[model samples]
Target: MKADVQLLITADGSHTAVNQVLNKTYHSIHGAYQESQRVYIELGLFSAFDAFPDGPIHVFEMGFGTGLNALLTAREAERQQRQIFYTTIDAYPMPPEATSQLNYDQFFGTSYLTALHESRWNEPVEVNPYFRLTKIESELQALQIDERFQLIYYDAFAPTAQPELWETEIFQQLADLLLPGGLLTTYCSRSYVQRNMRAAGFTVTKHSGPLHKRDILKAEKVR
Candidate 1:
């Protein structure tokens, strides 16, 4: 596949997602990364990771995007003495070359950059002593994972940009992969998405968002 393209940055220093044609229109590119941090790490996965009294943790991710969130979590696990099993999926995954362009390496520290970029597809790859990543390079609706998760990072693109991937059936399929009380967090705040999550058998809750966004949501699966 051709390399995935990124949008031009705005005067506000935020980038947008543009099509290959260089159109000004597309989804929120920078916001997606920021939102992932606000919802998944700050509100969901990190808290869940802390709640686990034991060491080693398992986290499932809905979108692999630039692997930003995964990298941050990996670094945390590496430093904090807890092992992490992080699984992420994507419909149109960016090449490792594109992933390397992002400066997460600088901010998240160079400790795991080599291991993070070298993680292979189609198998479980360990990036460090504490972090193991399994990447599924397929659309969200087609996930075929058998592992159970304690936390989920739902980082898919906006519902407007990709509606089919955020539907109830897909959420239900994801919910089935989680053990009881596993937490799932996302940047989406649409009522329909919340209702569908409820139908997927999660106890949903709405919460404040990060700097620019209005609100984010998290759903807890209990069964």
Candidate 2:
């Protein structure tokens, strides 16, 4: 319920997590757009979903903060005529008005994108023909979902601010909710996180670092 936690861009243009260390919005110096495109879009989504072109792909997002990624993915799925079951977990729900202020509609088109804003806190609404959004509006620990996901967007505040969410047990449970070959991507390059994912049965990989940092994580939950 606090402010949007804006960042002060450096001369080099990397955005830091002023509010929280790990969950930074974007640093212009680090090429926020580039990092996101590389970690989440290129490596995470494209690589994760490629072999399963005929799939009814399911995405599980941790810390559904700005809703930027959701809008982009939803619009892409719609364009490709793909069926997406997106389940995002967030302890604090952002006001719909704040989400509306973002330029999601400019990229995702207003008609359906507007609905996506109002979709917050609703009763598991199907935003469109291709997108089914289920927002768990409680602590992530309290969520009781048995369905596994094909892709997980591991976006959280950060280890320094909220370490419990990034612990091994939580990621392990996330792996349990995924089928073999399911992918989990995050902007974090923490060794502990990678080790935890391995403990949870993921086949971990070190990917090219984002613009801001030197490395990122892409792990697969293999059966």
Specify the highest-TM-score model's number: 1
TM-score of 2: 0.83
lDDT (C-alpha, whole model) for all candidates: 0.72, 0.71
Model 1, range 33-152, lDDT digits (tens) per residue? Answer: 465568877898677876675766789887665566787788677778788898887666665655556555665455565555566776888787888888777866666777898888
Q: How high a TM-score does candidate 1 get?
A: 0.86
lDDT for model 2 comes to 0.71
Tell me, by lDDT, which candidate is best: 1
Candidate 2, residue 46: how far the Cα is off, in Å? 1.2
Model 2: per-residue lDDT, tens digit, 129-207? 8888877777878889778888998877667778898888998778888878889988887899888888888888988
TM-scores vs. true structure, each candidate: 0.86, 0.83
Off by over 4 Å in 1: 7-34
Worst 10 residues of 2 by lDDT: 12-21
- Cα deviation at 114, candidate 1, in Å, is 4.0
